[model samples]
Target: MAWAAWLVLWALWALRGWSCLRCDPGSMQLLQELTGPYLSRQLRGDPGLRERLEALLQRSIEGLAELPIGLPSYMGVIDEKTMGEAAAHFRRAVTRIMENDYKDGQLFNEMMWSLQALRESFTSLMARFQREVFCPNKCGHMVHQFIDCRACRTEIYSCNRGLYCGERRLQVQEDDDLILDCALSWHRASYGAKSYRFYRARGNSEEVMVTSPDAFLLKKEVTANDSGRYRCEMLNTKGWVCSELRFQVTVTPLPGNSTPLPMPPLLGPLTLPPSSHPTPLGGPGDWTVWIIIGSSAGLVLLLIGGCAWLFRRQREVPKEDQDSPGGQLNT
Candidate 1:
């Protein structure tokens, strides 16, 4: 588990760098053209040459930003409007470069106003890339649940009941997975520092669907048995409940069935009741699938550490030669 945490840290670090550049696989070369030294000191001084070059560059930045696969790794939604603005600036920069070009091809020279403009544009685009483009965390979104979840993670602040509180009533068909979010932040400090526990109220007892070890609340292949009042709580590291979210799940029948099943018990408070049973977060959770990526980082770190140790060992003098000068036995 310690290794796992370290691996998680490493993958997260690596992801930070990978996310800085968000060009699509098909657009890498185009990105390089925009950011690279296409504006070199050397180019044909012919009158039509710069225009042709500008035209080519303009084509490169026209449809620059494709929809990036948004996953909420940093735990917030991408700013689409800002992202669009970035792509716009990306287009504007090259246009500026072309407009400011000279016979000398010195587009990036200090006196070039367009050079600064281009730089500023790319800087803005780069910031968007970090915050929205490659962010890795998943968020609890209220939009079209199937399509909207893929984009960057987003924190829910509006459209819910209270500032930090929200309730979602879902009418999911049978056999559909029931997924709920327990990572609600009631205050500034309560979001990431807590673990989530999920429960479904039975007759007199509430069965533990998911416990504190997992951050996600999920019951896969949910059937009629799974339909019940669901409560999710966020607990601090010390195992004290800190925040809660209520979910009302109505499991509708599959196609061809007209009548709807009974609704689950009423939604409960986000906070826990006085008496409760705590259970281990079971099934390794779906998050284990993602942690597999961290193992590769672990192996790479181990290899680097092993190599460093061997190199340092080779540089050391043998302990048996402690008395010998220059780490060599006389004669």
Candidate 2:
């Protein structure tokens, strides 16, 4: 049961990252604890082996997002949602890795779990994940994306198409940030796509995204410079584009001294914030507030005037008038 839950957590985290989670931190801690004990068994003598294994682990985790759940479909036809979607999902992931070019499969084979026994162990863990975690948490048709009680921020993003999350478009104010993901965003794909080039267009000019913090993830705090059309191309082993993901990012200037407009999560990774900027400070529905600030002051002044008028009228009535019936203070 614990291993199954770990599979769900590791896969979800590897795909969505921590931004979408709202649960406790124990999942990661449990994973780290488990990983150390397990790796220690095989990593006792060879000091260099640990480093290589760590790199393999990191790469494998990152690659998990792109590998679709289960193997390729039989035809263009899609399968109905059934009890074994989890198996299909994982089958796709494994098949994608193995089907990739030689280098991709080689890296996977080098991983500690490549051995038949360890591979079966990994498979067993995933099976438990399906029964305990996957089936019970099905919220919608998107089994690969929607995992568990939908523990996400205000939104979620995942791998759906050739790219992890399909296409996207964005228009946000200055100081806003963006994220873009694609097929080549993974470390390994069916094609020997080693790297991707990101490009943005402004009028006739364009700039390639080279120095971004990460190749798979694009964390850019949009400025005036960011406003324009954007595209990312996944190149195959032949150095030609195999897949293309495009976006039109428009960065509007934030008015001086005004609160920067809130930007909700985008369809895909582009919604990622907290690294560039925090996410939404809104609710499920829109709302409006009409504040009347000085109305209370106006009411106080009216009351004071009424009291002053009564006091003046009392003063106007002389003592002699009070003594006379016709000139009574009541008048």
Candidate 3:
């Protein structure tokens, strides 16, 4: 019974035609048409080119199909003889291109154009593939495109044609609302009429909305809980273009009650202390100290002289000598 179930599952997978999980069959077919021949040729002569082309193809396949296929692993599945035949075809094509001696500038421009086309084609393919792989019955139902917030690791979704496009970062405080602003511009060389859509996803919830007129801005205000991924899409007569910017919304906690720290005063150059200067032994300040010493000494000398005069006046010997001399003269 288990074997029967397994076989049935395998059959179902095979019936899916090994398509990519995120790409449409038509877009994938276009990619194969555009890149397959060149890639096959590169695989034959230049081993390095072969490796690079294989890696790119593998990345495209993984991005579109969500398959666990690697270049070496896939090569092992192919027979040696088949690989040789493919290589030979690629080598011949490369040889012809080299012989043509295409001008460098022209070749560069052509390559650029081809790469741009490839990118657009791959995006459509991936979108279709995702729809098929995830929502088989609801193919026409709107699917929310997911953009990742680089800051908070949140995944947000928005409508296909909304206003939030080309936003880089968003921040909100807890219990406070935050507003998001997004603006978009297109390359002037794009000649087709363009339209856009926006998407935002938070947690498991997603939202999608169409954008307003061209050259317009989108503003969205939501609380901290609304933080998530935001992105936008551009569509025109040519096809669809997506904004490369992934806006991340982060919600932070509010600050508690605290005074603002004051800035320190700016200090000028340091001045040397007056005492640090070498003082002359007989400088002006030294002379002042000496003058005070000299004045104190003179005051002491005057006090000593007054004291001696007072002591002499207090003595009786001077009066006796005067009386004796007068008596002798009279006799």
Candidate 4:
């Protein structure tokens, strides 16, 4: 914020004037007696006083040296740390004057009182700056869900994620009636925007029209007619305190009759042999089909070779039996 920088510059100027005033020979002599040897010797003369004051002021400026460029509208650039540090400096000055006494009692009292006032002013300013600038009192966040279907209107639902305004702090309440308001705004680009409230209550006994009286969900499906900014207001039991937030939602209806998405083209027609069905890939000429045929042919050849080898061995065994011994003719 440019205002923060301006405030810091003004503070530096004021501190410079104060330091110069304290550098006067008469004033320094009084401080010499009040603060003792350390402050008098180490922080003597106008230059030394200015240097010490500048060092204190520099602590705050250095803390906020990195300023963001083009910060978002929802975000703030105020430097809270710098303000806190400046407030601390004011408080310390107050303490220094109050802790010691000097020869001129009236002057010492007056200086202490002035420092006290400055300390209080800076402390209050820091708090107010943080509240109004850094932490804005606005509504919380909103989350919306859109359902896709072909109908008269699209189904939409949204919820308020927060209630209070301070940065991330929740505003807690009990037995509160939440009043929701919806307004329609057309022509998103135009500077002239018209908004109309959804339902307004007239009598004390009359109730506001809501999709759900208990929950935050909209009672009816949001149609194209329900496009605009929506704000929710919460009222306490006594109707004394109220909290509110604003959100925008748009609902677009699909055509009554829509064409289906086209299916992907097939590689080729699937065909199979009369005895076997098609493979898992919807075709018989796949790598899996070839692997199955090769394995079956190898098994059939192995079975035939085993049977022929066994038959040849059986015939040779009978002939070997007849050749053995002296033979049947000798018997």
Give the candidate number with the greatest lDDT: 1
Off by over 4 Å in 2: 1-167, 184-193, 211-219, 255-331
User: What C-alpha lDDT does candidate 2 achieve relative to the native structure?
Assistant: 0.45
Best model per TM-score: 1
Q: Write the per-residue lDDT of candidate 4 for residues 25-143, one digit (tens) a residue.
A: 34335434434443344335434543444454444333322223222321112233433444455545645654554323343345545545664554455455445443242343222
lDDT of every predicted structure (CA atoms): 0.49, 0.45, 0.45, 0.40
**Model 4 / residue 68 / CA error / Å:** 40
The alpha-carbon RMSD values of the candidates against the true structure, listed in the order shown, are: 40.0, 29.2, 20.5, 21.8
Q: Which stretch of 10 consecutive residues in model 1 shows the poorest summed lDDT?
A: 141-150
lDDT, model 1, position 214? 68
Q: Compose the digit string of candidate 2's lDDT tens values, residues 53-159.
A: 54554455444434334422111111123213433443444444344442322433432232333335435545554454332321211222233322222222222
Q: Global CA lDDT of candidate 3, please?
A: 0.45
- Give lDDT tens digits, candidate 3, residues 59-131: 5444433334443222112222332333343334334444443433443344444334434443443444344
TM-score of 3: 0.23
State the displacement of the C-alpha of residue 269, model 1, in Å, after optimal TM-score superposition. 64
Worst 10 residues of 3 by lDDT: 133-142
TM-score of each: 0.28, 0.27, 0.23, 0.23
Ranking by TM-score: 1, 2, 3, 4
**What is the descending lDDT order?**
1, 2, 3, 4
